[model samples]
Target: MDALPDTLPDAPGERLRIASYNIRKCLGTDRRRNPERTMRVIKRTAAEIAVLQEADRRLGDRPAALTPEVIAQASDYTPLPIAKNHVSLGWHGNAILVRPWIELEDLHHLDLPSFEPRGAVAADLRRDGQLLRVVGVHLGLRTPDRLRQLGAISDWLATQTRLPTLILGDFNEWSATAPLAPLKPDFNVLAPGPSFHARLRLAPLDRIAHCDLWEPARTGMLDEGEALRASDHLPIWGEFRLPG
Candidate 1:
């Protein structure tokens, strides 16, 4: 399995590694539910912040698919309390996990306009005096709804104080540009690589977009070991350097 580099060149800025993954509720392509294996793939990314889709079951209180105990045992990251209910880990199956040292200043759970129960989560985090905004979303299947969801997110961000921001998750859009128009003018949208249908690797549905305050360093998909079978969609990651 290929792991992302542990450290980057000691340049003039602070660096951050962020990743997005659709864990399919911890149900892998092998038709098995193994949250441990799913977390193993996440650990491989070595992301300081991870935006995850389908982290909880869809029905009946929406219980978390990846329990806190499993996450604690496998990694050093802590899951944000973005879920509305006590049983779930995220809102509408979208969750954010950050390293223990990162300070969470604020958070919001957005209810998107869609035919189904779809939502997004946003967090303001501070590390080493650098304040960053991160949004995690899992959009609807239809293109029109996806556009509307992005617009809603854009509108929400417009109301907040600007920071080095990142929006990442399973966008569920085939073309990275069209549906993501609302964010294009200010954010650099990137589809690291084909991450869907993990076994075949045919679509670039998972993506990360960042504002100009940060410079993109590297991005790629995790394709080896548990990553290949832990979920139907492989994890995609991005490394960015925030100027001091």
Candidate 2:
């Protein structure tokens, strides 16, 4: 692939690299240890915006900061999690982290069943002086559960005003028949196939999809091997540039 332009739009109408990953609660291949390893993997991905899945809250608390890198490794983001009781386990859901150059306005999370407080994170990012809506979602695992989750997200997104949007994350779908169908009219699933079960290298569970003013310069899984040998899922990254 060829190199994309260095500068991406920032004000309301610009382009950027946006990704999503299911850290599996930082569960390593060995099935032991979590936090530190998760941090390592995230630092390596180095995306401008990242939507993380399986970010469970301990004692029902989100991570520490709001920075993209901060939220990728820790549970720090805005809106300060009002409550946590949607799933059977409680306090596990999605988080969106954006780079400093980019700003997200109006952020919130949706509640889903089957998964532990499953929800979607939506934000209005400033690009090219234009506002773009980027949504991050971690849907339920079970087919039935996820079906409901998909409906909720599709319905919710329909209410938004027309704007570029990117919906990303560990969608939990292992086949080409992804639940992203309803979202097709607005945004497309930027990646090609399966991306989960990180250790086995099967399934494209983690993803980066977007719409308006952007082109996929390139995209794939991150392989750190050791620096951050944590999480059952591997990180999917993409390089995007502004559309002519």
Candidate 3:
């Protein structure tokens, strides 16, 4: 796979690429449920860690839309066991996939305050003595609920050990500032570009936010090849230089 562009020169710090995508339950914009195609788009990102929203179906048991077996066969990533049940791949459809070489130190499923069943997943990953924390979320539809969910996430993070952290997913909020204000105090939130309505590309619904320990090298949206037909929201990625 081709390497993602980086603005920074060679440095002593570790460089990591993380991506966020809303697979829409593996139902593509073409109106077909193709998990393999979704995996192909993810593989194209060449990300070390990928946080996915709507990874599982809504009704019934909320089984994984993209099965672990398929992901294992398609790429080197291994899905973290954050699901509440045996069949689901994530907690409330928020899932995280990382390279198998990365060690998982801790994991949490955060239940947010909302009228709908909304939640987020937090995972501590370690490699080569460097530790990183990632939180994957899919916020509720209403603006009020979105703010509440962000507050809930902040409350949950307040109790955890500090580390280089990244918060990513389909935020579901159209306006950039209002709903995400709660996170502004601590994180450097960035929306790479417009990724929603993948066919035409209008709104910037997907985003990545990180704390002070990491410096963003570059950020972009995957819009080529399979990405155009993969889902309604294109995958957004960011490369960050980890603290030495």
Candidate 4:
């Protein structure tokens, strides 16, 4: 779709391009989710904020910690560890990034019920005086798991008050089934997504949804040049304007 507005203007009025991608732990689905490839997809998006799924420090029972040194090697965005599984093994967790112009504050991770430690990372930022809440999330892989996770998410989101908010991630959704069921009443999912299995190129694996967007103006994937080198999954992006 069209480039996300250099700025997103809601009430008060801030502009930003937001995106989501499942980096497959920085390894391409083809093999070892390569961190180099993962970072490539990220830099190409030129988004103000991003939510990444499957970034790994370690996986399975032996969760590894993602060090600052690891993130610095691949991306320009600061990496924040938002959730870890029950054993405290932090192998995989949500990743959040804000562009240089956007200032972020109040970063926190949500602890949801699941075999995995699922979370929602949120921050407050300003663009020309319009304040907004932005969230980066990666829900559980199982249906019941996501359902439970969203419940806690909804409860917290209900308290957001007037600022426009964003929720982006690897929702693991293909059809309107479960994902839409719980969060649709409160938010809008940017359309025409197929973000996984990059070499094959299907978008079911990635998505961007929002609350308080006026017309839901555009939706698309970034797959050109350096973006292709980023990861197995493509980056999905969108734009929103205030209702007149």
Candidate 5:
């Protein structure tokens, strides 16, 4: 693949590398637990911020899928401080990991309206003297529930005064354009390409979006051979130019 443009035209700004991945609880196709392999995929992205889905076991106490020592041994990324419940790594299996340079100001979980158990984790982070709010979510599987969950998220975003807000995770939906109507006015929903079913990659289930405060420089899917084996869904990443 050819290299993309290194920089965007006009006013230059801080380049932020953002990524989103669904690790499938670190269980690969081989039917084995491999946190190291999952961490390797995340490290390969070189992302400053990555919102992870399924960072914990689904049953039996729901222990953390990725631990602090494992994260430290694999890369420089640190998981944000989220309210812990039942030894899980994150709230509702949605976790936000950031590079050491990114400092967390505040964190909370949003209870999304859903027929099933669904939620979002929001983090106020400061990077290079710039404040940004990041929301990591996993929407409900049903269409109607997803729409209502998005509406609830929109109501929450309205309360936030932050300019450059990012929402990333496994949306579990195929039609990205229609579902994002609530945020279309302010956020730019990007289709980095199909990221789900790593082997087939027929649908773009995992995605990332940002408010107009930042401009997208480059966006694409991280579908390496190793990434495909790590989980059922491939990771998607985007490089954004934050206003200076």
Candidate 6:
């Protein structure tokens, strides 16, 4: 396996790499539902933390597309407490996965208002004594609804005391800038690149928003040939600098 760059914190309280991917229910460009291919692309990111969108079936029992067993065998990662039912996976198709060594402190679900089912997953994690809040989300398609969802997320973030909060996932927005004015002055939004439609690579639908505690050192989309065949959207990752 090709090793991704070091995504771990440089020192005890340094930095880490966080990534986001909309796996499209593990359906590959070849028109086959391949969990192995999806996990292969995820492993390629070499991210310490990964936020996933569309991790479950859209209808029916909403069974998990990426089962825990497969994830364990494919990568050194584990899913956050986003799944409720034994067979279900994630909250409204949003899920969070963290490295095995990242200590989890708490986990919660943020229900966002939408014409369709939409929500966010919040994970309070500790690494080397540093606490980090990670929120995985998949916003709505409509502009107005997306704005409202962003507002709901912003309001919830206001009550948290964590310094470095990371918000990431499939935003479903087609703009270059995230329309999160309310979160401004407190959060910095980053779009790695055009991540949607991996074949054409036309839109920046995936993004990461973070608090001021850390600045992203580098960010980009993983569009390898295997990755493009794994899912419809390419995985995006960011390396952040630890606060001094």
Highest lDDT: give the candidate number.
1
Q: After superposition, how far is residue 60 of candidate 3 from its true place, in Å?
A: 0.8
Pairs of colliding residues, candidate 3: none
* Candidate 5 ranges with C-alpha deviation above 4 Å: 1-13, 176-179
Global Cα lDDT for candidate 2: 0.60
Q: Flag regions of model 4 displaced more than 4 Å.
A: 1-14, 29-33, 59-76, 80-92, 176-179, 213-215, 225-230
Which residue pairs in candidate 5 collide?
Answer: none
- Judging by TM-score against the true structure, name the best candidate: 1
RMSD of 2: 5.2
Please, what is the whole-model Cα lDDT of each candidate in the order they appear? 0.87, 0.60, 0.86, 0.62, 0.81, 0.84
For model 4, residues 58-177, the per-residue Cα lDDT tens digits are: 445534233345557765565534444543212236667555456665666667778876666777776555577777777777878877776788788777665687777777665543
lDDT of 3 by residue, 1-244 (tens): 2455433222223578889999999998899999999998888777788999999999999999999999988877889989889999998999998876678999988989999888899999986668889999898899889888998998788888888889999888777654487886788888988899899877888988899988898899888888999899999998899656
**TM-score of each model, paired residue for residue:** 0.94, 0.74, 0.93, 0.77, 0.92, 0.93
Q: Lowest summed lDDT over 10 consecutive residues: which window, candidate 1?
A: 5-14
Stretches > 4 Å off in candidate 2: 1-15, 58-91, 113-117, 177-179
* Sort order, lDDT high to low: 1, 3, 6, 5, 4, 2
The residue ranges of model 3 lying beyond 4 angstroms of the native Cα positions read 1-13, 177-179
Candidate 1 regions off by >4 Å? 1-3, 6-13, 176-179
Report the number of clashing residue pairs per model. Answer: 0, 22, 0, 16, 0, 0
- Flag regions of model 6 displaced more than 4 Å: 1-3, 6-14
Root-mean-square deviation per candidate: 2.7, 5.2, 3.4, 4.8, 3.8, 2.7
Tell me how far the alpha carbon of residue 20 in candidate 6 is from the true structure, in angstroms, after superposition.
0.2
Query: Which scores greater on lDDT, model 1 or model 2?
Result: 1
Report model 3's TM-score to 2 decimal places.
Answer: 0.93
